[model samples]
Target: MAGAVIVHHHARYKTYPGEVTGFVFFACLIASVGGCIFGYDIGLTAGLTSTESFLILFFPDIYRQQKEQVIKNQYCKFDSQELSLFGSSLFLSAAAASLFASPMARSFGRKWTLFSAATAYILGAFLGGVSTTFPVLLTGRILLGVGVGLCIHASPLYISEMAPAQHRGMLNILFQFMITVGILSASLTNYWTGKFIGGWGWRVGLAFAAVPGSVIALGSLAIPDTPASLLLRGESEAARLTLQQIRGIGIDEVKQEFDDLVAAAEESKAVTKPWRELLFGGKYKPQLTFALAIPFFQQLTGINVIMFYAPVLFKTMGFRQDASIVSSVITGLVNVFSTFVATMTADKVGRRALFLQGGTQMIISQILVGTFIGLQFGLSGTGAISEQYAMCIVLFVCVYVAGFAWSWGPMGWLIPSEVYPLAVRSQAQSITVAVNMVFTAFIGQIFLTLLCHLRFGLFYFFGAWVLLMTLFIAVLLPETKCVPLEEVAHVWRKHWFWREFMVDTSADARGAEMRKRIALEMS
Candidate 1:
């Protein structure tokens, strides 16, 4: 927060620099392709349910038995538990990869770690495509998860640091917007390829993930390393040169800015601090608590529950297989468009209102979904959802997705990165995201089974996810919009005076010596 002020000296400013900002935007655009890869791989998993390659890879015998028994449309059938494992393996392993990837990323330069991840990503995709058996396919998914592990951390970090501070929020949010785009791309790809070419089209879709994953890996080689990170590693001259190259600033200006950032980074070391210290320590415990809890609550909406099993859901809603996959494409489109609005408005709208809107709408949507399901059974008195009332069910679920895209989806990535301090940022971001994916794994499997066995009953679980999320958001959510990342902990601190200055607020405080230490360090 201390060095957040953007200095634009007229004397230092030359004539209009045509497309300088454009080039920077392009660089970030290319670098963030990893986000698209992450989104595509994860989002495509559900839609892949419509693909025969996915089925053949998991159910070789189903196809063979169909040849012998002539079971007609039931060629790909599997037990609920078996089907659940096949669908959920990708998320479960990615969650595991995310947990360890966070700390290692801090030590490794962001670019190199991502490169390593890309190799794994590419290999995973190829293997997943050719996998003849279940174990191989599962292995492929785990490897892809390793690649995603590095990307989910490094991609956003790269965007934030490379971006100008004034525009950082939206630019960083663009990473998530790209995520929506990737998901949409995957869903549409799945729909068209599966419907037109038949279910085996997943081979093509799985192969497509490799393209962006490879681009990000190669692209990382092109960009200069982040100046701040170099400064942290004692490569000050190199850091200054990198900053000048990227910022187009005079040597003196860049040097002064670099020193100030490092100085503040050092001072903030003592405040409840961000990330690792920010979440775990005494002063930052509450802020950290909110930071951790928000993501926990975000996933509870059972959003992934829907995403991972959307095709299965649409089928239950009474669509044929192809129609169901096409509907998933529509959901993907809604997700992409809504995220675009969020990227534009999050900073302009500020954080509090969006967070509130997101949580509140989720609650409404889930309750309505449950109500619609209950009515379908109660009024129709049959397991089938009535055709007349179907629109309401689809629209409410769409509204829930829109709310999430506007709020939690992008904000999940934005808030933690912004709220945490420099040192702990990587560590904490990794843990928060890891937990998000871990739960996604657990719930993703459970929800698919529930949808089949319980039918309309699946909405009840989501309704509960919404209820718990609402209470957590209402009570624990912090207003982080416009708050500089470095100083978020200071405002959120609970110790009366500590709340004021992020240390002992006044001489009367118990930790006066600690306060003095922080004050001197700050000065």
Candidate 2:
């Protein structure tokens, strides 16, 4: 929390200059295209594994399992290691790639990082389209995972830096919104392709990823790098012009905001070793904790349990193949529409409100889902439940999906991207992304195994995690709505728990220290 009283100046100027300009929207739009690639992959995996040609080509064991009519346990029918590998390989590579994405963002700038990710995505998609063997298919998936790691690490950071503090939450949520759009698009694509396109449908699904990749690659060239990124790279004039253009404000108004950015950047440059500081410095303890914890809890929310494997889960509950896919589409629709609600209310209602509201809702919905499944299926997991019971379970799953879409889904990205100082921002973001992907990959790989072993108990397992995470949010999280990125440390310093980790350095002392450090570096 050591900073100048410029926070007071920020407070006095209650009215912000930046509105959601067309330029801002366009920039956010382009940045958000990265989400489509991520979401498409998630939605595609559920249906891709279900397709007959895909199974025969790469996983015949699963195809045979699907054909068995001896009333095999509904939970264990699709439990194949090859299918788990196929579903999870992307996330493992993505987790590794996130560690590298930090330095890439810092060295090449956010815009170029996005462009590189898009290129990887396109290449991965093309490879997947042409793949004839399992190894080749997995290689393509790993490439896509690399793309996911880089894209997730950069896209939210870009949007946060580009947006005004007042509107940052909503703009960042645009990324999540685009992800839902991608999921919905993928769901629709799978439904039609699986039904009409016959044996080659999975190839078409894999190839279609190139479309969003192309959007991000071309769009990256068109948008300017963020002012914060520009300032960090020591391009003050360029940063000023970008700040002005994005803000759509008068010269003086632009200068005011630009000066804040300059001060933050100067303080940031004083830190020679950001990763060491992040790890060992007490002042950065809260950020490090938040960076790791938010994503950890977000994954624990069991949103991906639905997003990544909705069709498989539904089919296990007694729905026919086509009905399960349709059910996924329905959940995807709820995800999209619920995210739209977050986009509207996040800035206005603040982050904590949504987190608490959605967490409570998710807990209730998850418990309801668990109870319903236990009662209907019993322990043997031998027979299909009635249609009425299947519909009821789907309804509760929709509730759980809606809860996640609005809260942890977007705010997870929003909080980590905005909370860190410029010095350690990229590093912290990388940590966040890495943690998220690791857990995502973990859940994706083990989900079917859990389904087979735990059967109806899997929902309860997630429901328990949801209960714990909801308490964590209530006790630990501070409201960050409308706070500028540079001033975020102020919020930490004021919090009862996190304040212990913050040093109370005055603005003047911090400024003097920054100046001396810069002079020493220059000399």
Candidate 3:
């Protein structure tokens, strides 16, 4: 009976001890709170900007005389450019801060990097919550953006390094899942608060972001830095100890993995490429392009349009203020649930397949949304649609959200973190994430303005980009399921069509050959 019980435990938990898995899980969970904060900030603005009390308090110029009307239309006095700036401020700040993330992560280590981020979050939330004027509130959001930039850049890098290979994809994607949860939480909070707390509710919601940031800051202290970071710092013994703790195994058991990590670190150090090499030098051009393109396409899919302006979209679809908020909540729920699907299936089904499938679905959904809205409202914007038709627009928007949640949402972070070489991993990730934030800020800044000017045609613009993104993935993205981090460069080098672009020089060819040989021997 004891033997049988032991066998069952082995079957269920695999090689790691239950305690070790639990520890790793706890660490990752705490780290993921940063993602939750990102999501909360995104969702908070969507509902807050549409709330009557928030509008009156912050933008009295826009709120005057329309207070008795439905909340969605109450801010008609504000132009598109003003609304865009309000939504884009956080992302703009994030983009600026992302440029410095690599230096911070390399110099201070991942755990402390995240701790600093949490501190920024706390300060930003406090400033935002207490602000009486627009500039002060914008300043608070800028600080929050700095925090978001650091946390988003570091969280997945830490997770990918620490997690076991078999569980890595799921664990890494968990960061994205936490983001969806934060969005849902914020949406629900805004819904309830907007209904009950009057104008002060938005302030409370914005201030509440500090709670999770505080948790992440304190929790980061308990988790050790990644093994790779320690090795990079020449702290071999400390790296080994951290690996032992994370793997829940003894020194002997972790020896092989530790050796592999050290070897990879040494190899990475041997090729000391400057940051400019990632752009101007041809050595890392493929990786640099892949890193930038994936995240850029991710934003172009128009997912943030829904994330940042769901209530506004719903109003355009002809829903009432309360109904629009409720519909937005439904989209948030779908986003959270679909991300769970991605987390469970990422490793099993592979990244490329999900991207292809999800991209196709997103394209179709966007087309349908554009068609329905255009048909109802007309190109010149002089028609009205029935409630039934408006519901169709809402349904398709939910579908697009689901498609994105499971595909680009998770893969955007996962692929970039895994594909870059260890030496340039932090720098490459920062670049990609910075590019992501740039596009996010651009979209957030212009989406409402486009809606006013383009009306139903706005969906068509995004649909076209979705179609282009699908083609881009089908052509360039390679499957990276279960590939060792050190061999990721080989996967790109081995691509059937893009091999020339990825393998530019004689040294790269030799390096790729050597990595392939090593991968075979390890297998």
| CA shift of 163, model 1, Å | 2.7
TM-score of each predicted structure versus truth: 0.83, 0.94, 0.90
- CA deviation > 4 Å runs, candidate 3: 1-20, 65-79, 271-273, 503-523
- Tell me the deviation in Å of residue 103 in model 3: 0.5
The lDDT, on a scale of 0 to 1, for candidate 1 is 0.66
Scored by CA lDDT, what does every candidate get?
0.66, 0.86, 0.80
Instruction: Please report how far candidate 2 places residue 339 from its true position, in Å.
Output: 0.2
Report RMSD for candidate 1. 6.1
By summed lDDT, which 10 consecutive residues of candidate 2 come out lowest? 1-10
Per-residue alpha-carbon lDDT of candidate 3 for residues 1-523, written as tens digits (9 for 90 to 100): 0100112111221122213288888888887787898899889988877787777777776566444444342213224566677888888888878778898988788899999999999999999999989888988999999999999999999988887766778989889998999898888888888867446878888899999899999999999899998888788999999888888878766755676677767755665664866777676777888788988999999988888787766765667888888898999999999999999999888898889888888988988998887777675655556888878888888999999999999998888988887878888989988999999989888776677677667778998998898888888887777665755666666777667776455545555566446445544
Q: What TM-score does model 3 achieve against the real structure?
A: 0.90
Model 2, CA-based lDDT: 0.86
Task: Quote the RMSD, in angstroms, for model 3.
Answer: 5.3
Q: List the residue pairs that clash in candidate 2.
A: 4-507
Please provide, for model 2 over 4-78, each residue's C-alpha lDDT reduced to its tens digit, 9 standing for 90 to 100.
122331342122467889999899989998888999999999898777888888887778766874665777777
Off by over 4 Å in 2: 1-16, 68-71, 504-508, 512-523
* lDDT tens readout by residue for model 1, 393-477: 7788788889888888888777766766565666666777677777777776666555545555566777677677666655655
Candidate that scores best on TM-score: 2
